[model samples]
Target: MNWKNTTRQTLGTTVLCLAALAATAASAATQQMVSVKGSTLNMRSGPGTHTEVLWELKRGYPLKVLARKGRWLQVIDFEKDRGWVARSLTGSTPHHVVKSRVANMRSGPGTQHRIVGKVEYGEVLRTREKRADWVRVERDSGKIGWIAKRLLWGW
Candidate 1:
C-alpha cells in the first residue's frame, strides 16, 4: 500500500470540507434588531468598551450582523454605518430599511390606497405586520404606513 498517497488524499479532502463549511457559515450570517435593553447601546470602533465610541443606538434599532467575536458583534445599519456593538444588545426580531430613493407610504397595503407620506432612502422602519407583498411599518416619528416589500431590505 502507498501510505504517502493515502495521507495526501485525506488531507485534500479535509481541506475541501473546511472550505465548504466556511462558505455555509458565511451565508448564514443573521440579520437582527438592536435591543439596547434600557441603557443606550454604545457602538465602538472595536469589539470592547475600551475602544472609541463611534456612536450610540437606542432599543429596537435594526442592524445586519457581519461577524461576531466573544461578546461583540460587527454590524451595519440602514445608512451604511458600520461599527461594533455588544452581542447582548441584539435580537432576532425582523426589521426593514428603505432601499429606494423615496418610498411612497400608503394608507393601506396597496397602491390604490391614499398616499399617506414618503420615507427617504436609508430610513429605518419597525415591522408591525405583513400582508402579501406589502409590510406595515412604523417610523421613528410614530408614522404608520405600508410599503412594498421589494423596496426595502431585511423583508
Candidate 2:
C-alpha cells in the first residue's frame, strides 16, 4: 500500500477505537433511579421473564440501574442486592432508601437545619429535590425532610 493510504487506514482505526471507548465510558457513567411502576415487579436472576424469579418488588420501590439489556435492566437496591427486572415495569421517577441507621431528617439541607425526623435503616423515601450534598425526601408516611446524600442510596 502507498504511504498516504497506510496513514489514512491507521487514522480510521484510531477513530473507531476512540468511539468505542467513549461509548463504554458513557455506559459506565450512567447511574439513574428507576421506580417500580407495576403493583409487583419480578426481579429475576437473569435478564428475561423465563429466568428464575429472585424476588418481587412492590410498587414505588426504587432501584439503581447498573446496566441494560434489551427490555431488561440490571439493578441494585439499597441493600446492595443486584437483580434484573423488565424495563416496562420501572419508571424514571427518582427515589431514595436510607442506608444509615437512624438518618436524621432535617428542615433544611444541612447539619445546621433542625432535625425534623429520623429515618430508620431501609426506609424508602421519594426524592423531592436535591441541593449540594443533601437530598430532600418525602416518606410514604407523610414525613418530609432533607437528609445527607451519603446516608442514603439512590441515583
Candidate 3:
C-alpha cells in the first residue's frame, strides 16, 4: 500500500476512535438513578467497604447518580447531598408514586393562618423558601405562601 493511503486510513481510524470515546464519556456524565428500598440506606465515600458515613436514606428514595466506579455508584439526594452507595443496593422500582394533589396555600405554617389561595392537583408550584416543615410556594397568580411539603411529593 502507498504511504499516503496508509496514513490517511490510520488518521480516519484514530478520529473514529476518539469520537467514540468522547460519546461514552458524555453519556457517563449524564445523571441517572439507583433505587433504594427498606427503611434506611447508608451512603459511603467509596464503593465497597464503607469508610465514612455520608448520610442515611429512607425508603422510596430516588438518588441522582453522579458516576459509577466499579461496583459503587456516586449519588446525590434530594437536598443535593453527595455520597456513594453500593450498586447492589440500587435498582429500579415502579411502586413509588408522588401525588400532585395540594389542598390550600396558607400565609403561615398551620391552617389557622389566613388562606391565600387553593392549589389543585397537577399544578406546579415554585418553591421559594422553606421554614421547617413548611415551604413557601409561588402560585399561578403570583401569590406566595407556606405549604406543607409532606402533603406532596417530587418537590
- My TM-score estimates for the predictions, one after another, are 0.69, 0.81, 0.48
User: Where is model 1 more than 4 Å wrong at Cα?
Assistant: 1-22, 30-39, 99-102, 120-123, 131-133, 140-143
- lDDT (0 to 1) per candidate: 0.81, 0.89, 0.69
**Where is model 3 more than 4 Å wrong at Cα?**
1-30, 94-155
Mark the 10 consecutive residues where model 1 has the least summed lDDT.
30-39
lDDT by residue for model 3 (9-31), tens: 99999999999999888786655
Ranking by lDDT: 2, 1, 3
Q: Which candidate, 1 or 2, would have the higher TM-score against the true structure?
A: 2
Give the clashing residue pairs of candidate 1, or none.
none
Lowest-sum lDDT 10-residue window in model 3: 93-102
lDDT of 2 by residue, 36-71 (tens): 887789999999889999989876788988888999
Which run of 10 residues does model 2 get worst, by summed lDDT? 24-33
TM-score, structure 3 vs. true: 0.48
What TM-score would candidate 2 get against the native?
0.81
Cα lDDT tens digits, model 1, 1-155, are 59999999999999999999998877776544454443468889999988999988765667778788999999887678889998977775666878899999999999999989999886768888999999999887899999999898754
The top-ranked prediction according to lDDT is 2
Candidate 1: RMSD over Cα atoms?
Answer: 4.1
